[model samples]
Target: MSSSEPDRAVPDPRRWKALALLCVAMFVVNLDAQIVLLAIPSIEQDLGFTSGSEQWVLSAYLLTFGGLLMLGGRMADLLGRRRMFFIGTTMFLLASVLCGLAWTGEVLIAARTLQGASAAVMAPTALSILVTTFDEGSERNKALGIWSGIAGFGATAALLVGGPINDLLGWEWIFFLNVPIALILLGLGPVLLRESRGERRNAFDIAGAITVTLALVLLVYAVVEAPDAGWLSAQTLGLIAASIVVFAIFAWVETRSAAPLVPLRIFRNGTLVGGNIVMLLLGMIGFGMGLLVSLYAQQVLGYSALIFGLGMAVMTVMTVFGSAVGQALVTRVGFKPVAAGAMTLLGIGCLLLSRISPDGSYLGDILIPLLVFGPGLGGCYVAATIASQTGVAADEAGLASGINSAGFQIGGALGVAICSTVAASVTGAATGTVAINDGFRAAFIACVVFAVLGLAVALLLRANRPAASPAAPAAEDVPAPRTGAPVHAQAGE
Candidate 1:
């Protein structure tokens, strides 16, 4: 009998309970990320944050979240996912308290950074737990499908709730709300979730982690600052140069290290590389759309936070529908076609969004495109996730999952920075709503370009098939040698 078969045959109510717990945790994480958008005006009013500082409120969280995700994933494998999950949840809950109590812009930004780091650890480990618990079949697919669906819906739901919460209670309530949810999850997680550990003993690559994190931070800073500071400014040029050097060092270290943070060999697999590329594009497009559309709704269309949230809620409902359809199609039609088709639809949606004007109504200007883009992005997210892990060895699953999560997190930071820079440059301190609308139109055009690129990359992905590996003995096979003892002491190898 297959090793997984034994686990599958066991009637474990804990598995279903675990899935529910994780899904709620995921909803809270995603909600926090988007809920801030509705409360941005309130925050600015209370904290006196300038437009430039406002951007940092979002970017700081993203920077830390994206930069630390790979490290977080490796830590989960080394320490134990459930252990890491608890630790991360505790940190996140504490951070939320700090954010709610923050009196200054600096304090809020710092708190946001901590919140993002906690999210990085929690997000991937939740998915990893799901994968480890469920056998690869209908059950696994269904679990993942619900997970993906919640992710798709959570952003919009945040916007929907954010406005009312901020309006009725205060902006602080948005952060305060997470405390109860996290406490509940923390209470239940230990009892319901099973512990799993990676089989390989690898040393954590501290140097690689430092170099890569620095490189990404510098690169993103350069991209985001280039529009404000001239592209040829000394600061921008220096940061860009430093980024290249750091990345080169990271590559060299990974190749030579006995235990690398990110195994260089993983990229040699076509599916893994392709999936990461697709995920990057998906993040660039999907996140870019959210940032631009929210701005358009409030700044251009003269909508209140409440109305803007309502519009976003419409999009979230559609995204849930899209995830359902994508899950149904993946089994019968395969991943490649679904991904490619989704990208095409996403591009078409972006093209339509580019036509919005200052006078445009939500129904005419936003609703249709959001309906189309919702499903397209939803399908792409699932396909890229599945593709990333399709053939990964059990020992490398944590690392693979980390890279996948990092791709989206990093891509989001890059996308928001790039799109914001472009829009800011085009708008240029314009006071009129019409000028802001024009800037949003330009941003939408940029989103269309990204969607086209994503479509091209999606087409390059091969159809899903059984993976062949010399290292893969069989589903029931045990490791030839025990590596767990080494892993406990030296992580990220």
Candidate 2:
């Protein structure tokens, strides 16, 4: 029997319970990414963070989260998904408490960094567990759809709850909010989750792991600092070069290692490759646009943080709606069409947003574009996720999940940097509101380009499509490994 056959034949009765637990884990991860934004003002005031240093509140989290994800994912595959999940959740719980108790800016930044590292471990491992638990067909699609919707809620929840929490309680509550969620995960994890790991290897690729992680850390750090330091500044260029050199070394190390941290061969899976590429673009467009919109609504249009968040609630609702529709469409038609259509919508939305005036109202300027963009955001995320994991071996699921998550995280950092740089370049020496509006317009145009590029790449999924089979492949049905990657399909090829 194939390794995966038994899983199909005797599905776990607790799969749904496990899924619910895993979704909570994802919600926490996604929530942290945005929740801090709303609380930044309060955190700065209480912690005495200077204007320049305040950004570390967000940067510290993104840096650790993006840098360590690959290592965390690999650890999940080797150490045990359940074990990693438990460990990560424990760390996250502790970090949250530390953040809430922090007396200074430095302490809070340090705690946020730890929180990001723990999330890196939890995000991919939880996803790997979900992928393994559900059969890769309609059932899996449905699970992913729900997962996407919850993730949307988590992202929006920051806006929905963050303002009130900051106003009523304090910035500390933002971190404290995670305490209950993490405790629940830790308490219920053993009862709901099963232990699983990848194939045993004689030697762990310690060198490869270290080098790749260093490379990613450098890359994320460079991008996060680029907007302020100047893209071509000596520091930014030096860091970028260092990252490239380390990555090259990692590639060389992978080629020579018997049991590589990430098998070079895994990149042969075309669907995984294409899906990650699209995911990167989605992250870039989504995050870049989000930052610009916040600036436009609050800085230019004179809206309160709480009110702006409430206005954005519609976008969140539409994102959930889009995720469900995308899931259903992918199950019937295929991921390519669904993905392409999503990018098209995003492009249109960006085009609309680019035309926003300095005196624009939320209803006239923002809500209309968001109405079109939210579904696209929801659909693209779901489709790319399903596409990325379509035909992976059960053992490597953790690795795949990590790679997918990393793409989005890193892409978001890059997108923000690029968009901010563009905006700054256009707004140089201009103190006028109209000049700032011009910068925002340029940033939206950049997002439009990202969407267009995503559309182009989504089309390539058709080249080596994997035929959909009703059942998991048997031992005899498993095909020989191919030199090139396959564009795996969940529906008819």
Candidate with maximal TM-score: 2
Return the lDDT, model 2, position 123.
92
Model 2, 1-493: lDDT tens per residue?
5544444566667778888999999998988887788788888988999888989999899999999999999988887788899999999999999999999999999999999999999999998888877777888877877887777667666676777777778888889999999999988888888777776677899999999999999999999999999999999999999999999999999999998999888999889999999999998998888888988887789887778878888888888899999989888887888889999999999999999998889888998999999999999988888889888877788899999889888998999999999999998989878999999999999999999999999988754323354333112112334632221211111
Cα deviation of 373, candidate 1, in Å: 1.6
lDDT of each: 0.77, 0.85
Best-performing candidate as measured by lDDT: 2
**Candidate 1, residues 234-336: lDDT per residue as tens digits?**
9889999999999899999999988787778888889888878888888888788888988888888888887877777767887788778877776666667
* Model 2 weakest lDDT span, ten residues long: 484-493
TM-score of each: 0.90, 0.93
Off by over 4 Å in 2: 1-7, 463-493
State how far residue 311 of model 2 sits from its true place (Å): 1.0
